[model samples]
Target chain A: MKQILAVDDSMSMRMLLRASLTAAGFKVEEAEDGRAALEWLDNNSPTLVITDINMPRLDGFGLIAELRARDRFRDIPVLVLTTESSPEKKARAREAGATGWIVKPFDPEKLAAAVRRVTH
Target chain B: MLSALATEPRTRRHTIMQGESEVSSDQRMVLSTVLGSCIACCLFDPTLALGGMNHFLLPTPPEGRGEDRGEAERYGIYAMEVLVNAMLTRGASRATMRAHLYGGANLHEGMRAIGSKNAQFARDFLAADRIQLVREDTGGVLARRLELQPASGRVRCRHVAEHVPDGRPAAPPPSSGHVELF
Candidate 1:
């Protein structure tokens, strides 16, 4: 099974992600913030990193920058799952090495399709 | 801010109905709305003097309910995203954005707590996006009337008592009734 790391501060959102991804046949690891995500990444390598943009401490942008800076994590695809869909935000995510952008209230089927596309 | 604007005549006023959003860079425009078991988010970027407001009926579309993309703005997820994007179109940046939340009253005692859920969604959305939430007035059993000056980031919220079947105003529960500053 493909492994994924989902980072978000909202418990409800995390639960939704877990339920949706697990049902989609992927094993998902969870983190509350970008800092926690980094801590998790230190010991584990997931096929993909899905993150929320705004969070306490380190945010998704910082996390992406950190991932891009390190050789080991640099190749892993990062998907931004956020409520923001502005052109500026999207460009910034791409500049920071994001593989894709998915807006919030994502449909489970669409999200699964996105994951499969990136992982494959 | 509300008090300071009391005497200044608002040049334009727009009413934001439920499931609608409006953004403006004009300092003269003020957005107003009324809420019950709903939420209104006021977002402003002081640097650009641009802002927007959204009134959503629910936190997210009902799971597995076949919500289409066109009507997604009725939910918090799309409402907030659309509002932010609208502000950005007017040259506002997220880094300098500040937010204020209002409404979310559980007026119906025995029914589902939709109001609290909406309020929680707003809080989570703001936190997840790293927007600075400077003011919030949510929960309780009374509806609210809100006025927001998007460009100036000024807000005024008034808690209105719920009306009973007999048409008399219902007394507020002891735990509620505090005013939120702009």
Candidate 2:
């Protein structure tokens, strides 16, 4: 089974996503921020990462930067899931090695499609 | 239904109507309140159970809103930032101060998708910076009352549905479980 990492501070968000992903046959791991995501990464490697941009300890941009710095993680597909729609942030994310962007209150169908494309 | 279900009576209870947030101490209990249409983000330091709630009307002000309308305070971004900052000033860390956001019930009544929009805004704002919403009662054509024990982070949700709009859920808190009241 393909594993997916969902990094966000909201418990509900993780639950919501997990419900959808599980139904689609994907295993999901939850993280609250970039720092936490990093910690989770140290022990496990997920096939895909869906992270939010504004987190307490380490925001998405910072997380991507950290990911890109490591050769081992450089190739992992990262999907930015957030409410921030600024062009500047979007460009920054693309530059930081993000695979794509997914807005919140996400359409599970669309999200599943995105994840499927990147993971496979 | 509210009077009946809530008839059991809370030793102390607060009713935050839609588009309002308040901080108050009554008798021996200090209560902060609000109602959804807007979201009421309740910030509490569980160790201290000390916190405040902000009822932001729009994700941003409704475009042409007046400058002095305190419009700045009625935004999810500002509300989250301010409440967290306030709690921090009182010696709370961003990590420790858990957020309990209420409202954004997609009361899609009449012409306004206000509740849905608010819900999306709340999710985006908090998700941007990984803040977990512990408890939530959103969506439906119901008006909800949120009571937070800032000291313990124990919260109660009372649904008040008399007449309203149609919409989806606007709650952003991580779902632990939920008691559905229709």
What proportion of the real contacts between chains A and B does each prediction keep?
0.05, 0.00
Instruction: Provide the DockQ value for model 1.
Output: 0.09
Predicted structure with the largest DockQ when compared to the true one: 1
Clashes of each: 1, 20
Which residue ranges in model 2 land beyond 4 Å of their true spot? B1-182
Please report how far candidate 1 places residue A11 from its true position, in Å. 5.3
> What tens digits encode model 1's per-residue C-alpha lDDT throughout A1-120?
999999986656777789889999999999988999999999999999999887768889999999999999988989988766667887898889998888765667778888898889
lDDT of 2 at B48: 56
Q: TM-scores of the models, in the given order? A: 0.65, 0.50
TM-score for candidate 2, please give it: 0.50
- CAPRI grade of model 1: incorrect
Global CA lDDT of candidate 2, please? 0.64
iRMS of each prediction in angstroms? 15.9, 15.5
DockQ of each: 0.09, 0.03
Query: Please, what are the lDDT tens digits per residue for candidate 1 over residues B1-182?
Result: 22213425747998887657789878789888888878999998888777788888888767665235444556776577667656755666657888888888888877358889999989988887677888889988888888888778788888888542111112221211111111
